[model samples]
Target: MLLTTAAVMSALVLLASGGAWAFTGWASGRLDRIDPFGALGDRPEDGPRGALTFLLVGADDRSGLTREELDRLNLGRDEGGARTDTMMLVHLNRERDAISVVALPRDSWVTIPGHGPAKINAAYSFGGPQLAVQTVERATGVRIDHYAEVNFLGFLRVVDALGGVRICLPEPISDPRSGLQLPAGTHVVDGAGALAYVRTRSTAGGDLDRIDRQQRFISALLEAATDTRTLSDPARFTAFSETVLQTVTVDDGLTGGALLELGNQLRSVSMDDVTFTTVPAAQTDFTAPTGESAVLWDTEAARELFGRISRDEPLAEPSPPAAAQAGGAAEEPAQAAPELIVPPADITVQVRNGAGIQGLGARADEELRAAGFNVPVPADNWVGGTVEQTVVRHAAHRADSARTVAAALPGSRLERAGELGDGVEVVLGPDYQGVRAVEAAAPDSAGSGGIQAATATDNVCA
Candidate 1:
């Protein structure tokens, strides 16, 4: 997300100034000479005035790497040119208050313009940026206004030029596959280390976990890069710019002039204002038709999130605190109630008895019904464990539902119960107690079983 901010700001400033245009021409000429993706073609049509979009690609190529460094990084064959490992589309509102960057996993199964359904990253390899852009546009229905690709070598150079970036590690991270080793704590990572950190995917969560770490690192990098110390130092700024400019390949529209203007526009924005989140994904082991096991994107949430960005909107904020903290509060009589949208009944509310007592399910059901949900039937069997807590289950598609359920049961143990087909399910734990309801109907189908639809219609635009 921080990278998105930096990338966008860089584009705005560089493109608005004539220098950016010239730099882009030069960059394009260089890329043309390489022609790694084959012959370059005419550019996409620039849309009428509206939101500005940028597609940031992180390539895995290490052609610029030295033999010693390649051995150090454990990099295999020289990939010749670049292969995009990460693809993110960032949409900035015309007003610039809000920004959204949607990350598309490299392994996602998508239909390419000419190449049928293939790994999303293959589009870049098959036809280069033009094909990659077309593929993403068709997949998400979001038009990309510009593009930028950062090779691994370039990323390292920029990181080194920025004097390294500071990153916080909650636990020791070691990935022999990526040659990244760090102890638990805050560590300043140089360009090579940062690249390894961002590219690591051998941990428990795999690529998803790697993306989360990358997002955090990007946030830290943005904060560091925008610091007065870095920005005010001409030597540092120029070095950073040159390192970035060399490693980065941008569309004709993102010339140096545009980047300068963008930087000026975003001068007032702070690091805290920028946020990053991945498109919701299901923890699935399903094999693609190609027989490769891969995590699948939750199509519903992914589409909605991307649609918002296409319209230049900020992500929906986290659920309100009051709603989350309302658990177990005594009901007030004849008092004016704040207007808040109640999550649909279809949202599964799992009642778990954390109290380690009998009749907990009954009590939980009563509490849930009073909270405006139609309580589902309490399971006959008890969910026994030392870690006593209530849990909720909704399809990965029902992100809103998950948020609502989590808010309703604040401070309780919450774990993603994986993907569900339709409705939400609340399983009462043995510790649960209070009034009981036999079965609660889903909110959407009036009595059918399915996850609840999103209740709020607020535009994603911040």
Candidate 2:
């Protein structure tokens, strides 16, 4: 899904600026082209003039690889038809300031226009690119402005061209079928190893787990491809872009000149402005009408997700509409939701007994530990007046970590305390609810409360 989009976005980054712009104008002609929309008369209407949405797909078709290549790569028998290994819906806001890459679960149980009920990936397999586009548009209700597909094989070449990518697993991962085996540590993986790493499917969460890996992988890849040294080197940029373009096939409209224009528009997008997430799934083991297992998107949540994109609204909670201006209204600037980049295991918190209930601080400390945060020091008494609302206090620099702490404690308020220094304090109050079962995700508060996003950089205020 994002694997190819990562390459495309990274390519735009390299082509937008630097001396490589003209070179990409020439190289764009080398990109594989397809007319995926010509026959679709019922396409979704064009959205905001300045906004753009791209459907990026990665094909796992093994039919094209030679016998020797398959043997070396451990690719199984060809499935005969084209099925998307991964799919992502990429939205670029009108301002070109933020990008959201939403990974579409290939196993999603969705209706394929004329094909009745089946897994979403089957759309590509049954009707080629046209049906895939139509199916996604029908399901998500968001007009896709452009389309691009990539062969997963290209991922290897690009990674190798960039001299491998560095990734650290907080835990070990092993998949014999894909031949991806790695211990819990940081390592620079080459092309084949990178391929195996992405294609591995031994995780407990199934596709959900793979999506997380893909997110981290794409983020890491983008970081590597956009590294200062890589961009500064013409020879390196050319090779990397060539390898990427070779693997991608876009719709007829995305021409060489169009790509150059896109490059310029996206030049301002920083790593922090880009976010990788998945469509919220209500059920992962849904039994479809066809009696096959499939992922089912939360109908309401998925609709709201797309509707927000359609309105050109920020993925984060929408700021209260600017009080009607004197003469005219103002645009609601994009606010990315707060996302937890650092793992809970890496964060430390000190519980303070402000509630005065017996062993309140100790109970809070134990809950936080079970929730995955580190608490090295024992609980302490707050000694202040009786507290009402629980508060997570930390220095300004640790706001992200503080958010994690606050998020772990439902209804807790996050605050900055100058005296706290490097220490983070969670003062349990009388109103303290039990610790929230957490995940490595942006806090998706119920209702219209502004959406908080977790990003690697916490890119705020441009």
Candidate 3:
């Protein structure tokens, strides 16, 4: 939830340009820094050029708090190590004129670098921000250009500094651990209440539900923070900046000036320009080999979901399956016109194993041959690790062939890889079922089930 963070970041640009040199000078010292990507080797340089992605982590660390204040806040003993209670991938597509904020469930199962498969959030606990950044980049093939962390106290202070944020409650709820107790209705919650609202997992949908509420709160926070009252007041603006600067911990790439440039890029962005969604998941109560309950993502859908973001493509609502439709009448897709169709035999493909399943690459290669398509031998591993879905990528000139190859492989999504050489490149995800006969088209929608979404302009309720 970047309600306050987004507001602060977006408004910081204005402050930097409005002759707040003294404040900027003061801010340089206030903001903390950590090189989250240091151990990960030289970062990839060819990320989406016109877009920037930041990993915003809400840490549950209670360090640096006086005993008295901790007790007064009802905060229990400091959790020795910090774990991200909330994580969001904030994407700013400068060329596309859109800002996408995607919330990732902490409980989602993923492979940690050193540890085996575990909750995505555990990446932070296993090795702090570096591991967390690595985990996210591997899980979602999108490159993380920046990282930001805010602890419990920092979040509380930010909310308090802004005079609190308004939230609508569906029913009365009380979560002892988070110390959140609220009546059913729309109410403005203070720092503590805001923390509790976002941290509580006792509700119906558990963490998944909390994410929805966080997204809503972010919208409300941005609306209130950017309101005329808050922006027009010189004193309030300065105070808010001080609170944020002291709280947010960013990577080296997000310097004050870099942040201002990011803000400048997003200056034209509005509530209408902001869209929020969660990574698609298959199950929430999946039991890992270690017997720990974790969230299982819908691999195929999740890959396509993040792949689109990596390419700065618009995220549209998912279309329902033909079988799920009334009367089960299949509508042939219009986007796959005859001119856009290429015979499987006429297409050449290079298969890359992104699915972690052993021998999947070889199997996919064999399947492609059986389907009468030319497959390049000796497939390579998708850099980073496994993916959730099989994707067909091609250069701009091979768009029609990519679509044709996609049709041959059921459930595969097509992507344009400008850097790719001739022919289609198939990155098989973990969900690769065998290659099948080219069939009617998949639905035109860009997203699918288990993915929750809301635009800043929407009145989304948890």
Among these predictions, the greatest lDDT belongs to: 2
User: Global lDDT for candidate 2?
Assistant: 0.67
Number of backbone collisions per candidate, in order? 47, 9, 1
Candidate 2 clashes between residue pairs 3 or more apart in a chain or in different chains: 317-450, 317-451, 337-452, 337-453, 338-452, 338-453, 338-454, 339-453, 339-454
Residue 178 of model 3 has an lDDT of 73
Which tens-of-lDDT digit does each residue in 401-440 have in candidate 2?
5766777777777654433323467888998887876665
Q: What lDDT does the true structure give each of the candidates? A: 0.55, 0.67, 0.66
Please write out the lDDT profile of model 3 over residues 233-340, one tens digit for every residue: 888867766777777777887666765555555556667667777776667788889898888887876877787788887665322221222232222242452332
- 1 or 2, which is superior by lDDT? 2
Off by over 4 Å in 2: 1-25, 317-445, 448-453, 456-462
Candidate 2 residue 423 C-alpha distance from true site, Å: 24
Comparison by TM-score, 2 against 3, better one: 2
Lowest summed lDDT across 10 adjacent residues in model 2 is found at: 328-337
Q: Which stretches of candidate 3 lie over 4 Å from their true place?
A: 1-23, 42-45, 71-74, 317-451, 459-462
Tens digits of per-residue lDDT for model 1, 240-294: 6666566666766654455556655655554434545566554345588889876
